[model samples]
Target: MPVRSPYPDVEIPEISLFDFLFTDFGGRDAEPALIDGGSGASISFAELRGMVEKIAAALAERGIAKGDVVGIFAPNTPYYAAVFHGILRANAIVTSANSLYSPGELAHQLTDSGAKLLFTVSPFLDRAAAAAEQAGLPADSIIVLDAAEGYTSLHDLWGTTAATPAQDTLPTDTAVLPYSSGTTGLAKGVILTHRNLVANLLQIQQMGTVTGDTRILAVLPFFHIYGMTVMMNQGLHANATVITMPKFDLPEFLRIIADHRIQRVYIAPPVAVALAKHPIVDQYDLSCIDIIFSGAAPLDAELGHAMGKRLGCTVLQGYGMTELSPVSHCMPDDRPDLDLNSSGFALPNIVCKLVDPETGEEVGPGGRGELWVKGPNVMVGYLNNPEATAITLDDEGYLHTGDVAEVTEDGVFSIVDRVKELIKYKGYQVPPAELEALLLTNPKIADAAVIGVRDDEGEEVPKAFVVLQDGVELSADDVMAFVAERIAPHKKVRVVEFIDVIPKSASGKILRKDLRAREAAKA
Candidate 1:
């Protein structure tokens, strides 16, 4: 039997994403919705709703119909929320691409997602144009977020009259296609339906994290699932004033928190580390902050507690994946007495179980196993990859999370380790396979294996073990520089070790455990 959520099931409405968010905005129309952290510009709820409809009409005018995949390849801005909902309102799927992706990386996602159109900012126009070209998308298919000399601004798409596209969207229809590498392999599109996103939003709302009066500081990148749901959607759903920062600059982050009197902050582990130890934090007044919630990756208990003490606020953590519509377990705001290390109880209507990996049997309370979950928040499937979908979601609809966790007697879940080979670098996923493939492209490199190794800052980084070809002369800096030019900065190879061979199994799979042991011996 699966462990049910301690909380009662909340009603999930069978409605489209747009209706769920904007249907009851009459009273809150004049309220501030999204405030630009940099320029102090803002959009009222009324203006946001109108812009969403106009952008939808613009998309329809451009011949974008239902089921078409549209890509957003820009950083977080107040306009991002408008464009994202507009794509959904047009009955199309929005696939958000990382702003830091290189041309090649961006091209792969665009081609794989079968994106018919792309929305990007002017700063990324050069790479976006190159990627669009590589993906066989014409120049006209690209729209700039900010108006450029030859290109039209996204604002231009809005018309004075609100036009609603044909209402063909179902609750189960895929709404967002955020890509994830699942447990292993290259990144694949995760199919989150309208119901999946709405269910998770409702589930999170029941947790009582965000209230109507909550002032949120959103510095987390909207491209990632964590920020999309927690910071952007949840903040809007609760009618909170969300201050949007395009990127995370520590000094700016502190200043905004102080200036805006932000009450709630949602961040990842690295930022938590900074808050705990950074000297600059003492320079600012963060007294208004009520809660600091950390997700995306694990937060060390010691660091979490330290940060709470330093800021005089409640520090909490949550757990989820891109395939789970991003949140399954979170520390409820009402339950501040729970252990900071645990990810907290399963959200309402979510069923969680711990199963023995080798025996494939359910574990009792306190026994460790791969965490399996069944909930409305679980994704529909992986786009264009039925095999991966089948592997992740079983016939009974349970998602194998690939995370080894233990549930306490009182129903708290704590992640112990990962059963998969993917590395979490500062909350950003760095798949070893993606890095190894790039390493093999070098003429001097004969064979390579990549693994996550801890740096002095206690953060995970990709470390490459290279076996060079005969008579090849290459320095570690040369190898690192080679990869840095071709991939995103976060995925760059930070540490390199020359080895005689890359240990592998008989089936030719890389023995990462053996490599990890060797690294442990060195430490």
Candidate 2:
């Protein structure tokens, strides 16, 4: 028997995401819905809705329509939200690419998702243009949110005399396509439908409190499912103000929380390290913060406790993945007393099972096993990859989350380790296969395998186990620099060790567990 959520199930309404989020403002039309923390500019609820309508009309004028996939490859900003909803309001699908993606990386998503157009900021125009050309999208399809030399601007997208397009999307229609590595391999688009997103919003609502008075901080990139659903959409669903930061900077993050009087902050474990131990954190007054919620990776209880004690706020943690629409378990607002090490209880409408991977038997409370989740918030499937989809989601409607977990009889779940080969670096997914493939491209390297290992600070970083070609010389930094130049910063090879051979199975699969054992022995 599967363990169910402790909380009452939430009613997931049958509606499109646009209608679900934008249909009501509840008389706070004049209140700020989104604030740009860097520039201090804001967009009120009324203004944002108006912007959405005009942008949608402009997109329709440019031939975007139902079933069309549009890409948003920009950072967190009030305009990012506007364009995101505008794509949906235009009855088009959104494939949000990571803001840190290199041109090649962005092109992969664009080609894979079949995106017709891409929305980006002026600062990212160079990369956007390169990716667009590589993906076979015309230059005219690149729209800059702000000023650019010759590209279409958001200003151009506005002031359309044409009416906004009618909403043709159904609850079951695909909405946003955020790519994830899932259990392993290269990034694949996670097919989250309108209902999947809406269901997650409602399910999260039953687990936590986010009133209109709450001010959520969004420093994590909006491309990741954690920030997309929990920080961006959840803030909108509650009609609360959300403060946006394009990237994480310690002093800047501290200042934004103090200056904005932000009540809630959603961060990964790494940020907690900065908040707890960084000397600059003491200079800022963070007394206004009410809750500091951590996700994406496991949070150390001691670190969480230290951060909360320092800031005089409650520290909480949750467990999720891209395939579960990102959240199936979290600590409730009222249950701060639950072990900070645990992910608290399963969220409403989530049914969880722990199964022994070796024996194919269900494991109860005290036993460790892989977690399986079934819920309304689960994704439909991976886009255009039925084989990968079948491997992740089983016939029983459960998503076979590759993370190993343990649960108590009371329904509390704690993610202890990952069964997948992907490494979590500062909350970003770094797929080993992607890195291994990149390493093989180097002429001096004969073979390579990448795995996660703890650095001095205890954060996970990708370490390359390499075999060099005979008579060739390459330093550790040389290997790191080669990979850093070719991939996004997060996927950079941090540590490198030249070895004679990388352990492999008979079928030619890199035995990651053997590499992990070697790492353990070294430690």
Candidate 3:
């Protein structure tokens, strides 16, 4: 009836996030835990543990308590681990905000999550303050990771008396609230409990090999679930030295890999494309890299093989979503005989089923269907949105992943397509509904439909089909600029076309398939 993981189940500890990651430093405390890629600055494991305790005390002194929500709106930095663990140490939930979000976008998440405190950096203070004001958070609630004129610095929290260990929290309590557009629609918070995160960490550990000597390069944004669980938490749990890059820059990425002698890299398909085709890759020596693991989007097998061949490493892929605590399946480092095109087998303790979307019958091996998964790694629910949660997580506890996939007789899974309408731009979720709503705000646009179309780079981008008002003229550049001003850079509409009518179903739903066919014809 269901396909099970090939590996044995892992033993997940019933502990807080802080205890799980920071408690067992062992003899590696003096070693570097995190390193800043740009300046080569580092934080030792012992120092990081101390900082988490002290910051937890500071947050408690500021009236933050168990069940309170705190926001981190900064990029990947050496101090990020300290701040993130400190929030958990204080027994508060951490809601990571996208650093690239516009003030309005940031305000929505802060307001929706009911965050009382926001931890940010110097460059983002102005926007953070704006968002804080909009969310009704006081100026004093803003703490700058880097010291600023009026804001509190992380160092200022160090001398305070450390707070006692986190109170006994049930493993079922929510630990992180990273938002995602589950199947289709606007973004909603995905409630991942402590157990959900811990289970995923343990599951991934069982599926792959990561030891104390592993050196990982973290270029993926930590705000996304993929980076948070796979790179940040798992790296720490495995006692690896993680090198953080604030953003992706090809030359800088190459330099960091060479300089750090990074042994493993976690990436998405777009980055894999760049590594495979970019001419500058030959300039650096990447022989130290042992594994290149790709996730967040489907990667072309040829591209993965090409990159692996060029870098002299093993290329692998995994598949999951924000609602599944981000990862349910991954390619094992030891499984060199598996197909590179497949996303790999389920992680230990995970149960996956494929059911025909139209007939609602279970699909056997070699047949395709929408994938449904049941595991400890699945999310608790969407925060404050029970209806959406009900639609996603069935009464039987299986999560509808909204992905069409096929399973092999040996339990390997391969994603074929998405049943939902969410567009992924370089691993970032861009909802078509969000873009359609924004397009309606333009004066000249009468009706519009947004769909993802691939560009020359093989990356998905939001393409808008607009029906302008009768006798009104608007340039495509003007339409693009209008969306750019209202949304984040990744959500911007990169392609536009003027059409007279938008195909719709009898139920008044946009026929996205028709639009996709039109785009395919043009291509």
Candidate 4:
């Protein structure tokens, strides 16, 4: 039996994302749609739509046609939103690369997505230009959002008098290409359609209490789906004011939140640790926050409760992957009493089945299994990688989420850990995410990651890589003792290594592959 959403299905419109978000402003035309947190610059809904029109007109004039893919490699900003919608308005697709990507990484995405043009800022020109060259795009194809000498600037694009192209995109048309390293492999582009994006917006609107008055703080990078759909698009659909930060600086982040009087703050678990324990957090008045919704990683329940207590707000969590347009299950804004560990009920139009990974047997409530999701928001397939797509999505159209999860009889779902990342200690499974979350609760530990490593007998065991707070002294023995007292023998940390920082992805996922490579180098 499939686990269906508790809420009734919401109607998704058969239109492009451009029509879904930019069409209906009404009284919000004069209101601020986006704001730059650093410079305090704002663009009203009317102004943003104008920019989108001009950029679309320019793109069409420059020969950008339907089905063409444009690349964006910039950080979070008010202009990012304009360009993002502008590409769609021109009936083109967008393949957004992580701003922190190197030339090789960006080039890989550009080449794979067959991007015809790129959008970036002046500060990132060096990397973007190098990637553009590697991807075989002409020098004239690069457009810097901020003025960069010699390159085509946003002002140049805005100078076009050409008419915006008519919307030719269908619901099935591909919208955005975001790369994700599925269950196990190299990074591959996840093909999200316009219908997928529009479906998620309608689905999310029913879960969160985001109204026109809500202020969303978008510090997360828009290249990732968590930021793309959850923070940016969701804000636009609700007609909420979205404040964008180019990058994360602790002091700057706090100041922006305090200054903007933001109501809804969406964050990954890493930021929650800072909000809960960082001494500098006391300097800011964050009582304006009404809901701190966490996604992208499993948040520790204790840390979530601590942050909520300190800030006097509701702390909620959600679960999704890049393949799911990033959200299928989330705690409703009103359900503050729900356990922080659970991702709450499924959104409308989603059916989930928990199946045993090894046996292929369906597991009901109270049993752990790989979560297979069937929904309208599920991605059609991986871009140009049929083999990979076939491995993930089944004949039934359910995406076999590589993550293991459990559901309560009441329909509450809790994500356990990635099936591939789970550690096997003497045949007993030990979840690294659980260990990492527990490590974050320690007062002296700043951050942590756990991966399975072979001991002297070639037996796999959980080894912890810890990042200590500045000026704090701790030994490997001390760390081992701390964990040994906490859990079962099989789950105890057998090896401990302290480092300056834990390698993590842009979305705050621990880059265990990098850690595994490091261990392999020693071997």
Per-model TM-score versus the true fold: 0.98, 0.99, 0.98, 0.83
Could you tell me which residue pairs clash in candidate 3? Answer: none
Each model's lDDT:
0.92, 0.93, 0.91, 0.89
Global lDDT of model 4: 0.89
Give the alpha carbon lDDT tens digit for every residue of 1-523 in model 3: 7998988888888887777888787679999999999999999999898888889888988888889999999999989889988888888999999989989999999999999999999999988999999999999989988889988888788868756555656788889999898889988999999999999999999877888899999999888898899998988999999999999999999999999999999998889988998999999989999999999999889899999988989999999999998999888999856788899999998999998889989998999999999999999889999999999999999999999999998899999988889998988899999999999988899999999998887789999999999998899999999999988899999999999999999998999999999988876
Q: Write the per-residue lDDT of candidate 1 for residues 52-85, one digit (tens) a residue.
A: 8888988988889999999999888889999999
Using TM-score, rank the candidates from best to worst.
2, 1, 3, 4
Give the C-alpha miss distance for residue 181 in model 1, angstroms. 0.6
Return the top candidate by TM-score: 2
Residue-level lDDT tens digits of model 4 in 234-317: 999999999999877899999999999999999877788789989999999988999999987778799899999999999999
| Candidate no. 4 TM-score | 0.83
In the range 322-357, model 2's lDDT, one tens digit per residue, is 888889999998899999999998888989899898
Rank order by lDDT, top first? 2, 1, 3, 4
RMSD of each: 1.2, 0.9, 1.2, 10.2
Clashes of 1: 0
Best by lDDT: 2
